[model samples]
Target: MLSQLQKKLLNDFQQDFPLSPAPYADIAKTLGVSEQEVLSALQELKQLDFISRIGPVFPPNSLGNSMLVAMSVPEEQLQTVAEIINQFQEVNHNYHRENRFNLWFVLIGNNQNHLHAVISEIESETGFPAMRLPMIANYFINLGFELDWND
Candidate 1:
């Protein structure tokens, strides 16, 4: 069951999250709760699988260099390769797709050179060549949506 505080937290702050040093504290102030309460609720939400992550979404190519990489890993080695790829902090997230390029992920770095070096390292470590699909056009996708607590 979800508490009213948790419902409000989920419904209220999808966009325009605080960017200050004490973001949670700022949220607490806005919600009229203690900072610790907000943090504990978020942790509980994660443990209950209500939320996967809490972070900012930046515009493409606005912060730093990034690339979309795909790999065709053998079905038997899919999980293992995904684990190895996750070991890199540069990797944002990876998912398995139904296409021939079964595994895809986004890698971010300080510059193009850094991005290439990380890609090289990933290719070497996984023993599979990565197909780099650089961004040719920018598209805005709004990731935030209202959660239906009634569901």
Candidate 2:
């Protein structure tokens, strides 16, 4: 169960997140709370797994190179392989799929070379070949939606 302030933080600030120098402070001002309260709530939200991450979302290949990479890992090794891949700072997110390419993640790098290097490092560390699936098309989907607090 989440408190009202936690619910508000999750629902209200999904989009138009404060972009000022002290964004959390700005949010606290709007929410009638201290900046420490806002930061503590956010930390709790993350610890509870209500949010995976909070940051900017750049278009594919807009600021840097990015590619969707997949790996076929044995079921028993899935967790270990996923953790190994997550060690890379370039990896944005990784998830499991019910298919041969069960492990999939997006890697963003400064350039093509950096992208491939990270991929190679991941393969070497995990001992699994990565299938690079470059984005051929772009789609626009608003990631933010109103959270039903009542539920």
Q: Which regions of candidate 1 fall more than 4 Å away from where they truly are?
A: 17-57, 141-143
Q: Roughly what TM-score does model 2 have, to 2 decimal places?
A: 0.64
TM-score of each: 0.69, 0.64
Q: Kindly list the per-residue Cα lDDT of model 1 for residues 20-74, writing each as its tens digit.
A: 9999999999999999999999999989988877887778788988899999999
- Can you write out model 2's per-residue Cα lDDT over 1-151, one digit (the tens) per residue? 8878888898887778977899999999999999999999999999999987888876678888889999999999999999999999999999999999999999988888889998999999999999999888888676688787654
Model 1 clash pairs are: none
The residue pairs in collision within model 2 are none
Count of clashing residue pairs in every prediction: 0, 0
Per-model C-alpha lDDT, please?
Answer: 0.91, 0.91
Runs of candidate 2 with Cα error greater than 4 angstroms are: 19-57, 76-89, 120-128, 141-143
